[model samples]
Target: MAQLTVDIIRARVEEDWTRIVEVLNRKIALQSISAKGITAEHMKRSAEFVAEQLREVGVDANVVQSHNPDGTPGAWEVTGSKIVDPGAPTVLLYAHHDVQPVPDESAWRTDPFVGTEIDGRLYGRGAADDGGGIAIHCGALKALGDELGVNIKVFIEGEEEMGSPSFIPFIESHRDEFAADVIIVADSGNWSADIPSLTTSLRGNTDIDVTIKALEHPVHSGQFGGPILDANTLAAILIASMYDANGDLAVPGIVAEDPIGGLQRDLDEATVREDSGALASYRFAGTGSLAARMWTKPSVTVIGFDAHPVEGSFNVISPQTTFRLSLRTSPNQRPEEAQEALAAFLVEHAPFGAEVSVKRGENGMGWAMDPNAEATKDALAAMQEAFGVTPINKGEGGSIPFIPELQRIFPAAQVLVTGPEDPKANAHSPNESISLPGLKNNVITEALLLAKLAQ
Candidate 1:
C-alpha cells in the first residue's frame, strides 16, 4: 500500500468528534421503532434530521419519501452527495436510521432511547446498530470537506431492523440514485474491539410466523387430560423436531458450505463461549468447530412465541400456539429457498392431527464477495493503513440482507462491509453500546479509504 497524507484528515475527524457524539445522541433519542405504530411522520422526521447533519458535512442532501409494493408509504430515506468529479468513481456510504424496539426496557442501564456515555462507551438501542453509524459517516465527510476524492453518495435507510420489508421496492423505485462503483456498509462489526475485520461473507435470513391449533378453545385439563394434544405441547414437539439429538438443525434442503474460504476464521470454544455469554457448564451444540457451524452452516431459532408464561399457573390448556421462527441460511443458500423448505418441514411433521399453518415473512439473500476484487484490494489496504495493522478477514454470522441485494443490483461495483461493534457492543440485546475509540478509528479508516478511492 502506498502512503498518503491522512494526518490532516485524522485531526479534522478529531475536531468533529464532539459534534458527532451530539448527532448520535440526538439520533438515539428518537424512538424510530418501525414495527410498532411509530408513525411514518416520525420516521420521516428522523431521516430529515440526518439530512441536516450530512448537509453540515457539505453533502447535497434531501429527504425522499417512498412507498411499499402495495403503494402504501414506505421507508423515508435521506440521500446525500458530495461529488468531487463526475468522471471519478463513486462510493455509496450506507447506514440505517431506524432501530429495533426495546422489548425489555427494564433490562437497560439507561433509557434505551437516551444515549449515555459511561466508561468510554455510548449506550443506546441504536448506538452501534446504526446511530453511531450515521455519526461515523458525518464525521468522516466533515473531515474530508471539499477535497474528498471520490463521488460520494450517502444513504440513510429508514426500516432496516424491520427486516427491510419495503426495501426492495424502494431501491427499485430509485435505482439510479444509488448507482456507484463502491459501497461502504457501516452495519457490520469488527472481529473484536481491538482487531479490525473485513467481512467478506454474510448469512441470509428468513422468518415464519406459525400457529398450531389443537382445539378451537381452551380445554379443561381434568376432563380431557389423558390423550389431549394441547396446542402448546404440539408446538413444543414441532420445535423439538427442528434440531437433532446433537442439537444441530435437522431440516433438509437448506444449503451448507465448507467454512474453508480465504476469509474464514478459526473460532475456538473459548471465543464462542465469551461472545455468547453462555454459562461455563453449558456445552455447545452442532458438529465441527464453532466457527464452521456458525459461519458456514444453517441454523433455526424460534425467536418469538405467543403462549402463556410459566409465572402464572393455569389449569386450562392453550387452544393454539403461535411462534415466530427465524432461520439463518448459509451464504451458499438463498433465503427464499430456505424459507420454503422450512415451511414444508413444519407442516409435514405436525403431531397428532394438529392443524398447522405457516406464514412466511420477508427474506434476504446472503453475500460473499471475491477477496481478489480490486475494490476489495483497495479496501483491505485502506483498512490496514487506517487501523495501523493488517485487518483480519472473516465471515460474519449475522445477516445484512441488503449487501447481497446490492451485489445483485450492481454486480460490477465492490461492496466493502465494516462497522464499530464488538462482542461486547451487544447490538440488539440490552446494554447495547458503541465503542468510542473504535468508532473514531473506523471513521479515520473510512476517511482514509474515501481519499484513496478518489485516486
Candidate 2:
C-alpha cells in the first residue's frame, strides 16, 4: 500500500465512481420509506444493504436494531468499524438510509423508487436527502483502501426521516463502540454544484396544534351569522396574527439574528425565487438578508388545517377548527421557550372570545458550532482543494434533531457537517436528485479529510 494523498484519493474515487453510482441506485430501489414508521421489511433490507457495502470495504459490519421499552427490536441501524490502528483517532460517518414517503407518485418525472440519471443528476426518492451521503462514505472508504491510516466507524440510520424515534436509545446502548474524535454528518447540502460549504448552524422546530371554538354545535348561518362569528373566521384571524405587515413572524420570545456580517456567502434573491419555484409575481416574506431570514430568524407555516370541504355543501356555523403550526426557531433559541411563547400568544390573541386549545407536538433543539474548529478547518481545506474553490460556512433552516443529540452524547467529538446535495437537489420533493459531479467531489473531500485526520 502507498501513502494516501489528496491526488491519490481523487484519482481512486474517479476510477471507481461508476460502481459507486450503481450501489446508490441499488440502495434507492429498496423503497425504504420510514416516515410513517419503520414497519416495512424494505427498511431492514436497506440496513442490510448498507452493511454489505461496508463489509465490501473490509469493515466489520452488522445490521443492528434498537430495542423498545419492552426489549423488542424497534428501529434498524447499520454499524461497522475499520481500524487501521488501535491508538489512532477514530472518525464516525453518519447518514440515514430511510427516506420520506412518496405521497404523490404521479408528480414524479421518473419513478420515485428507480434511480434515473438525466443531465448529470440522479433523481430518486432518497437520491439526495441521504442516499448520496451513503455513497460519499462508501466511495471514500473504497478510495482509501489499504493506505487508510485512522480508525473509522460507519453508522447508517434507518429511522431519521421518521424523527429518529430510537436514536437516543441506540446511541446509549453502544456509546463506547461508536464514540469517536470526529463525527462527519453527511446529511446537509452545499452552496451550489460548483461551490462547497460546511454547515455550522441548524434551526430548531416545534409544531403546535391550535383549535379555535366559537360555537358549541352547527347553527343556521342565515339566522346566527349576524352576531356570532364562525370558527372558520376566528381561526383565520388567529393565523393572520402570526405575521406583521412585513410578513415576518411576530411571535414574541423567539430569537432572531442578522447573519449578513457572519455568513461567508450571500444567498442570491433571484436564485432563491427560482429555486423555490415561486410565481413571478409572488413576494417574499420577512426582512434582512435572505440567508438570515431563512437560517437564523423565526418563521411559521401552517402545515395542516382541518375544515369542512367545499364539495360537501354546508351552510352552518362550524363549532371549531384546528390548524397545525410548524414553527422554526432561531438556532440559539430554546424550543421549549418558543413553544410556550407561541402558545401564550395564541391564547392571549384568541379572536371573538373563541375557546383556544393549543396542543404542543414535536419539539427539537437547534445546533450551532464554530466553523474555525480544528476538524472543521481540515474539512473546509479538503473541500476547497477537491472543489477547486474557496469553501463557505453555511446554515440550514431545516432541523436535524439528532445532530444536537450527537453533540450531547459525545460532547468532545468534533462534528463536521457536509454532504453531496446542491441547491437544485430538491430533496423531499417530487424531483429529488443529486448532482453527479458534486457527489464525486464530496467523495474526494471526505477521503482527503480522513487522511488528514490521521496526521
Which candidate number has the best TM-score?
A: 2
lDDT (C-alpha, whole model) for all candidates: 0.83, 0.88
**Poorly placed runs, candidate 2 (over 4 Å):** 1-4, 35-40, 102-106, 111-114, 216-227, 313-315
Query: Model 1 clash tally?
Result: 0
What lDDT tens digits, residue by residue, belong to model 1 across residues 239-259? 998888888888888877656
lDDT of 2 by residue, 339-402 (tens): 9999999999998788999999989998887665789888988899899999877899989988
Q: What are the root-mean-square deviations of the candidates from the true structure over C-alphas? A: 3.9, 2.6
Q: How many angstroms is residue 300 displaced in model 2 relative to the true structure, after the best TM-score fit?
A: 1.2
TM values, all candidates: 0.83, 0.91
- The TM-score of candidate 2 is 0.91
Those runs of model 1 whose alpha carbons end farther than 4 Å from true positions after fitting are: 1-3, 35-41, 103-106, 111-114, 207-245, 274-277, 303-325, 340-362
Candidate with the greatest lDDT versus the true structure: 2
